[model samples]
Target: MVAVVTKRYQILQYVSWMEPVGRRSLADQMHVSERIMRTDIDFLRQQGLLDSSKSGVVLTARGRDVFTSMDQFMNEMLGVQDSEKQLAERLGIDHVLIVPGDADQSARVLDDMGTALAQTMQVMLPLGEQIIAVMGGTTLARAASRMNFQLSAGRELTFVPARGGVGETVAIQANSVAAAMAQSTGGTYRVLYIPENVSEETYQPLLNEPSVKEVLALIDKSSVVIHSVGEALAMAERRRMSDDILQLLRDHHAVAEAFGTFFDAAGNVVYKIPKIGLRIKDLDQIPYVFAIAGGQSKAQAIQAYMQHAPKQTWLITDAGAAQSILMG
Candidate 1:
């Protein structure tokens, strides 16, 4: 079958390039086992394409031909570029699927990113196991809008607002975005009812309330987090930050805003709003953190978030943002 051929071909390619590699190493790389590698190797050897010696196993002359064909196929499939691949690598992300163009092309890029993300989620997440924690923003809302709920059948998932966005505009509020995503995925949701920028006095009290407390507890348990980075200047304007706070951020050259916190490109805390929602410590506990944002304007924001983000965080952005990020 074509499926079986594809699997064996992949194994051969890995062994040929990573040859002199032991059974354990092959198993580890393929996330399989020594047994599986041995079986595949035996099959390859029988095909006369692989030869085994006392030292280790390697490709035979015939094997090299097969390796060349497979290598060419892989190159064609992954023929983006070294520079772009390096950008993804530098971000320490698993994959960076970029759509070409600039800020003016953001709508098309966002559509493509959303569709790709929806497809990726369908593949990466198993049925009845997804737990998404989301932030609210225009880009995120668009992404959620494009999700295919039919692909999530039998999934027992819940979407929770990553932070409070009660006072934010409807389109960019955490609760609104989470609810939209939940609706799109045919899942349920829990909202952070409290405002993102409540007074310190109000914040402590709200956190003690049973309703808010329950949502915060759920957020802590979330395994996946999806959020958008915000430019500090734009977010300050949106939040109506005090003139003094704005001045402080400008003085420090603050570039990004995340979960009510602002940071400069160097990862220094420029300013913070006392919000009653998920804390930075809580973000670290999640296994998958997807920071989704795009456009040249969001480059600095994305960079600043990447600097302070948890090591496991994965960034999803477009070519414009990626190029701007490298330039910065």
Candidate 2:
């Protein structure tokens, strides 16, 4: 009986929300053919759970009771609540949101994590003018795309790239991500065009440029910083680092990379590229810092970086990563 109810639970829940909805519509929403749905609908109908008519289908009183009762069970089935609590305590983060699935195995999981990030920003963003510093990465780019327009409603927002990112592809660069976020949320943005990986000689001169200085000032004033962490080797590859630098990361047993600096599992800075941008120490100043990443593959990197992450930081990851961390 439990197995039967669980199998058809989604159908009942959907019908409850969209009462008087046609079976054709329900089938479409559930991504199933009418033939496939008929069997469950018939079984549910015979069990006095839901009624189908020429007009549509609606849950019976008993069906509504069952659906309501199973709401928590649905969430529990995904194990999100337990994972969220455990991950936050272990990581010492202020908040943690764990979505279901391994993002590396499922693109949809990444999309879902992006949605979770947008929702977190909505809650964390405080009143008054907000300067949001964003970092470059594929994860952040997905987040920028999924940002809701309502995020801009009745708010003042200015998005700025957290650092220079000339080393990355344009699509996932901080500049592009900041601009995309502003556009989606109906806000404004500033761009930083300096190279992310620059030597001390070139870095000093770029700081003298008025435009660069202006953006740097905005970054300093940013109230919130949104960024993602990467595995050291993967990030070094993304930046197209020299073979010598790659070898250095390997030699140091670097496990995580953030803000142009690589770290081992114990959070010691193995090496840092002289990039003109947000430093890890700066996070202590920002009232809100959101670190978003998922996939079990990132569990080691996330754990490594969180060792040094600010206590105020909010981590958004998936169940796969969370479980992996707790298992350790």
TM per model?
A: 0.74, 0.76
Model 2 TM-score (2 dp): 0.76
lDDT of each: 0.72, 0.82
Model 1 lDDT tens row, 144-250? 88775654555777889887764567876888888888888788898877765567777777778888888888887788888778899888888777788889999
Query: What is the overall TM-score of model 1 with all chains considered together?
Result: 0.74
What tens digits encode model 2's per-residue C-alpha lDDT throughout 249-321?
A: 9999999998888999888899988888799999998988989999999999999999889988888888888
At residue 219, candidate 1 shows an lDDT of: 82
| Candidate 2, RMSD to the unseen true structure | 11.9
What residue pairs are clashing in model 2? none
